[model samples]
Target: MSESTNLREPHAQLVMAHGWLLRGRIWQPLQQQLEPQWSCWAPDLPGFGSAQRPPGLSPTLPAYGRWLAQEAKQRAAGVPLVLLGHSLGGSVVLHAAALLGDQLQGIVLLGCGGGVYQRRPFARLRQVGCALSWFQGDRRAARGLLLNSTQRRAVAGLPKLVSQLAMPSLWIGGGNDQVMQPVYVRHLAGYAPDHQIEVLPGAGHLPMRDQPAALAEVLIPWLQRLASPRS
Candidate 1:
């Protein structure tokens, strides 16, 4: 068994990006599981949680992508960080990785991956996601984000980015996830080299909320892998 790490004074920083319409605090359970080994900081994606979409900034894919990379850099303070992002945030992190260059140590994509969405279900999700955001009072931001996301053609570029990556990558999914199903997660593994993939048994789309312990059960081992030198 691996030894437990101290909660305070973590050895490495873990910059977490939560899913759309979700706040950073959702990562609290997983952060606890990662304590001592990783100092975790989960940031609210713009238009979600306490963050607001700035004027003239459309909540498109690129917009969130830019915000995340900048936020992670500022928060890390010159220290390289491991980026862990969930759902839509998962997609944002990959785009951000392109700009981060070598400062990014690694990436862990949770409950998200690239693949063609099965039309109807995805449309339903878009409707629900957009409605929820509007109800929350960020109509324009939510609508724009949802519109851009529904264009599945953009998915093709997702794998290409992972293929061209400079560091390690890990992809995880909840076994029972209805959104961005595990099969899509499997699709990502096809493109990424040295990519690690795991599925938390019986978990759903929001594993960080539903099965954080199980999410962490496999998560710690993967973090340990980051410590070992890779060829």
Candidate 2:
């Protein structure tokens, strides 16, 4: 379907928030897979993709979270909205879920941040490198920096806040993800014991890009189950 097609009107609205530095187009493959059953809205986060950065904001995760919350509130409008966020977008959805409360039906976190708090010293250097890349107008670099930063900030507090997240959640991880790592995924599983976890084989940091069909195969069923009437 064309980018202009409104995916929020008739079917269940699937809000697919992209990771840092990437545009909404990242979701195109998955969107195509879901087709008419799921209308996808993948909006660019502030300061990234096609979305403009808000004035005076630091373009940090918290700032993005607030902006996303407001947008979801306005656009969701009582619809059964399901949130699927990648990397930094994962962390954004977490904060948005907290802010939106009952308005959200479920959340899917793909190669998510906020899974582990501490990292090796080189990880810090990686972060520095990412920041430098952003200054050079490299969005992919900026995205990496954002994901790393979000993970660092949210990891410590995530367990506590996750307990308060009553929404049914799903965590998708790349088995070969060098960035987030399997240890982090294990930590996430322990934190949200009730939530489902799926690991994509042969996938990297961007599982949606690497394994769109695999991701969708896992995601669509969960969305449908969540949409079903509860006993």
Candidate 3:
């Protein structure tokens, strides 16, 4: 985790959502950047981080979304809030924002997946093989899921909903991100034409780790814009 900083002075509330296989602390770098201007809250997913997984709960994405929404609502208390989500968190945020509606000021999606693209049959087979391998303690399986197109499709419904979202949003992508390919970014732009996209050159899937400063530079401006009242 990045060094802790004073957040009370920012006067703006923030909610952060982490990517898969990662906990809330994975947002440390991004949090550090926004702390000067926002009081940030990063929560662990139901089954990940410090949060205990509910027994018999389905591990599907919608279940995660519902859990996150309930948690964010308790934390937000109807205050206008800023939401920043990465990868899996991106889908979670989309669902939460749809539920929160006008209560949320804006949303930022980093290295998000889900698109109209379809994976080949062989690719699906490969993904299942890799998932099984990972279950069997193959470290390579972890890397395979991170790079698979099938995983991207699993969350495609998110962007469709986000497109109709009334609030402003910023869609950021790492220039070299393998997980959410450049084409996916374009697809996102097509869906949410009102939103802006920031591409960090030479960065990868984890831009918060690879390019913290760049992420902050883009994020700060968007947050400020959101805070400003429209004429």
Candidate 4:
């Protein structure tokens, strides 16, 4: 009954993807708010917090997207998964959805609005991130994550990701999020005609940490609507 198998499977309830350098636990609080009504699956992608980089694995954005598609498929036993991704994870799942096709019920991007970066700033930002990751270890795990995060290869696919998607897409941003503010979120929303935008007022970059209750309120209703028979 798995989506990965030859047989077409039923729709998945939901699956969550965390941002870069983070573990599956990132979705714990969110899960707590929505559980009993719905269950969530959060994977620790390779080279992130608790997950080690697999040997010889390509650490590019496209590679991560393909990997997440498989992971979501495995968890989606006969059901189209309602996919949610945070920051870098959001972008990753966008690419993942391209592969998932009808197996995905819908897509939600939290604090990650896709857009092309200004060349000079993006390069400098990438350099800074890589430097910090290099400071973390000699294995270069962090560096790879940072690279995929800010690379043009990732942004290059946004139009394609949006164009090919046929499901409802939601873009949620923190009102106070300096990293990906409303302007940035707005930019991301424009790319996908099917997307709905929600900015959590008074919430910062990590709304799950800064204002969990409010974040839950914003998220739960949309999910319920999705699960309803009317949807």
Candidate 5:
């Protein structure tokens, strides 16, 4: 995990999880926009960016969830934390929530959700993933991440995780996100006990890069609301 360079006293710690095949630094623009107010930490998950996959670390969501939960806890040092995850990372957060318990103040899911496994869509996704792996830079971590995402059990377990969530949550979808459509986002949000949903118009899958300010605009007010009672 890495910390924001800014020195201001943070309102709360924000730990961001990157999507599959992406590195922690991908959150740079969003972190920059949120800095001074939020103490942002974006870790390069094993096998991506500068991090190496540990010898026994599996490619499944539960394993990754354990890894993230530990990392978030150590970094937080008892401070309240808000977990923000994008795409596959959102699924990871769902798995980690139960493990985090009270240390987690809230969760934010961006461009991620799926309770039902559409065989055709998943097949197509695997096909695209194969092509990307073959043509793009070779990273063993990419293969593992893709494997977890396409698995039926993993995708099907998302709703159960959401249903079990005891903390507040915010689910956001890109108006133009063809990858994880608004329909899926809404579907998953329905399972949450306490949740709010929002859409960023004209933004696609990578809104952190394409619409950082807009995403932050939605996040700030929500974080403030969560902080009130604790304050």
Candidate 6:
């Protein structure tokens, strides 16, 4: 799923990961905007969309992180690689960062944060997510992802992962995002040693889809900085 146009040689590679009960196709709008400049691939994570989970792959965040890292390795084509994740996808990106090491240029997170575990809220989320997935995505994938969000290891490890990030990162939040409020986004950004946070005043959970140009306005400049030749 390389979505780059052949109009020009791409300067970098981007891998887009989607959130729970969502497929990679959700990134199409943003991919179109990035165009020939960025060689972008948005794969449906296993158990979501048309992808099937490998025989032994479990429905854990770490397992998905490994899969994402391998996917990026294959698609990198010796160019700078950046991972962009939305919501739950951001958690996956954090898990894969250390594994990608120096090959990873940077990371962009949208509507994703919160290492704190709220028991009742998480339990309610699992139930609501599972119910909604039956209509929007794979029931199995939704169940596993919802379960992962509630696990001690996944929730507790997020802050450490954010704090340990060696590469610079950008975290974006929607001012009206009820799903993951801007507060959580700022909260997590505080942990990273090198990070920038942006909030789109009119956007919500799915900014890439709802506000592509606005999202791009915040994204393109940061990407330019990353793609710049290091002295």
TM-score of each: 0.89, 0.83, 0.81, 0.87, 0.92, 0.93
User: What is residue 9's positional error in candidate 1, in angstroms?
Assistant: 4.4
Rate residue 109 of model 1 by lDDT.
92
Model 3 C-alpha lDDT per residue in residues 125-187, reported as the tens digit of each score: 456655654543323323333444246555456567767777888888988898787668767
C-alpha lDDT values of all predictions: 0.79, 0.72, 0.71, 0.75, 0.88, 0.88
Order of quality (lDDT): 6, 5, 1, 4, 2, 3
Weakest lDDT window of 10 consecutive positions for candidate 3: 136-145
lDDT of 2 by residue, 180-217 (tens): 77557656656764688888888888877768889889
Q: With candidate 4 superimposed using the best TM-score fit, by how many Å does residue 125's alpha carbon deviate from the native?
A: 1.6
Residue 109, candidate 6: C-alpha displacement in angstroms: 0.3
- Clash statistics: count for each candidate: 1, 0, 0, 7, 0, 0
Per-model RMSD to reference: 2.7, 4.7, 5.4, 5.5, 3.9, 3.4
Model 6 lDDT on a 0 to 1 scale: 0.88
Error at 122, model 3, angstroms = 8.8
Which candidate leads in TM-score?
Answer: 6
Q: What is candidate 2's local distance difference test score?
A: 0.72
- The TM-score between candidate 3 and the true structure equals 0.81
Of 4 and 6, the candidate ahead on lDDT is 6
Off by over 4 Å in 1: 1-9, 229-231
Candidate 6 lDDT over residue span 182-224, tens digit each: 9999998889999999999989999989998899989989998
Model 1, global lDDT: 0.79
TM-score of 1: 0.89
Candidate 5 pairs with clashing backbones: none
Query: Candidate 6 has which clashing residue pairs, if any?
Result: none
Lowest summed lDDT window (length 10), candidate 4? 3-12
Better of 2 and 6 by TM-score: 6
Model 4 CA lDDT for position 4 = 50
